[model samples]
Target: MSTPTSDVHATSPAAEYLAFTLGQEEYGIDIQKVSEIRSYETPTRIANAPEFVKGVVNLRGIIVPIVDMRIKFKLGTPSYDQFTVVIILNIGHRVVGMVVDRVSDVTTLLPEQIKPAPEIGSAMNTDHIVGLGTLDERMLILVDIDKLMSSAEMGLIDAVAA
Candidate 1:
């Protein structure tokens, strides 16, 4: 029988991310960056920000900016509903919320199952995708959240700090 250590060593850290459905495709992000998951809540809008920036919301006592992943990825505008979820991400030392279609369970995949993002045939920009995790018959698009929500893209977070 193979020991757990051997099993763990066989896979890469990318396997630890939580995979979820965005639009019609699957996407994954490292679980370490995820703070909490909540249902969609209307956020207070800020003026003069990028079109994709959803706005800021009061999560408990902390104010967090929310970005619609659909718009950020150029996947098209998203409509908020009960099914939508706010995925709170701690990227670049700032806590921001992102609206996703839904939340899926966390699962692990072997390193061999993950392939670098393909150059073509993707609906949205492939720059943010770190790799593709093939599990069974499904594929999870692994995302680099730090790159997606860089400090430059979320200036408001810094502005509020000053």
Candidate 2:
């Protein structure tokens, strides 16, 4: 006979995240959400769109909206350079692109390696933050890309579809 606690432990599997940098902080998103990575390019400006929502770019036949994570998180002034890249993500049925400083590498984290995000009150929204991943001396702010992209305030997914 097996214990319930042991069964729960057995079911918890390791998850892989695509690590990237936004300003000085390192962020990680679920690997499955990543569609592809492309070098930064100037996107056609959309009038009335939020500043963080840089604009849209034609990806093949699809028009993908690009969101600058730096601006969205209020990290600092964003700069475009050789290291800049767009991480195309497949969230829900919509495709979105996220601009990041640079991509680090894919990291696999076990359940034990992830720490719960602290409850810091309503001043900041932590709903999209999965947890903090610790590996060696590196710490990654794991983000729930799907939730962040689909949030009501973003108005991205629905607007793009329509």
Candidate 3:
């Protein structure tokens, strides 16, 4: 006869996130959404575009809109240096690029390691914030890249199509 055993230590499957920095805060996006990471390059400016929407760059034959995450987040004046990079993302059927200070590393988090985003007051919009992931002493602000890139305020998808 065999005895039954408990699996109390079992954890939910892990999800991977590509970690990057904007200003002083560390943020993460679903690894699957990241198409590629490229070095920073000055993109051609578009008139009447929002300050955050840096401009567009040609990737092969594709015109990709680039947004500076620092400006979009109101993280104060951004300084583009050697560490800056553009994280090309594939959102839905569109491809967009977001400029970040620097990328850290891809982190894997178990379901238990992620906590729901706190409900803050209405002064700030937290719709894009998916959750907070904790690993060791590091905390990652997980963002819903799809929601963010498709939001009307960015006008990224519509602008690209037009």
Candidate 4:
């Protein structure tokens, strides 16, 4: 008889996720896309940008745009503190940065551990939600950072780099 591992490997592979929080909701993104994590530092504000766009930062010569997930997700106003950190993500062609409440340890989840998220209508943008990752007692909202940043609304960059 074929083992479950054989089937799982054929369909999908285990992947690492970098977990973080925005208000009360815990979220994660693919670890492969994460370039680095830096302490929260105030960025230079830009003119005529969305409220969520906290402006851009100079990271090793590259001007990276910073997005506050709390503000973008409407997860209450984020109080910037020492614990806050910017997750440097290499999504698409743009190396963007996101300000998360705090950084949780990187966790690896098998394909079976990710479950489909229930439809919640337009109240929440589901386009970026890859699935709900259940690891033991904790559940993480898996986010497709690629899609989130590429969406016309985010305006940072494009998906499927040309």
Say which candidate scores most in lDDT. 2
- What Cα-based lDDT does every candidate model obtain? 0.80, 0.89, 0.88, 0.85
Better of 1 and 3 by TM-score: 3
Residue-level lDDT for 90 in candidate 4: 87
Full-model lDDT, candidate 2? 0.89
Q: Give lDDT tens digits, candidate 1, residues 1-162.
A: 998866865653545887777789889998889999999988887777677777788877888888888887777768888889999988866888888998888978777777878888655566777889888998999999887777466565456432
Q: What is the lDDT of residue 135 in candidate 1?
A: 89
lDDT of 3 by residue, 1-162 (tens): 332322322534689999999988999999999999999999998877778888889999988888899998899998999999999999988888999999999999887788889999798889999999999999999999988887686565357435
- On TM-score, the candidate that comes out on top is 2
Off by over 4 Å in 4: 1-11, 154-162
RMSD of each: 4.5, 2.0, 4.5, 3.7
- Model 2 — which ten-residue stretch has the worst lDDT? 153-162
Which candidate would rank higher by TM-score, 1 or 2?
Answer: 2
Instruction: State every prediction's TM-score relative to the real structure.
Output: 0.83, 0.92, 0.90, 0.88
Task: Quote the positional error of residue 38 for candidate 2 in Å.
Answer: 0.2
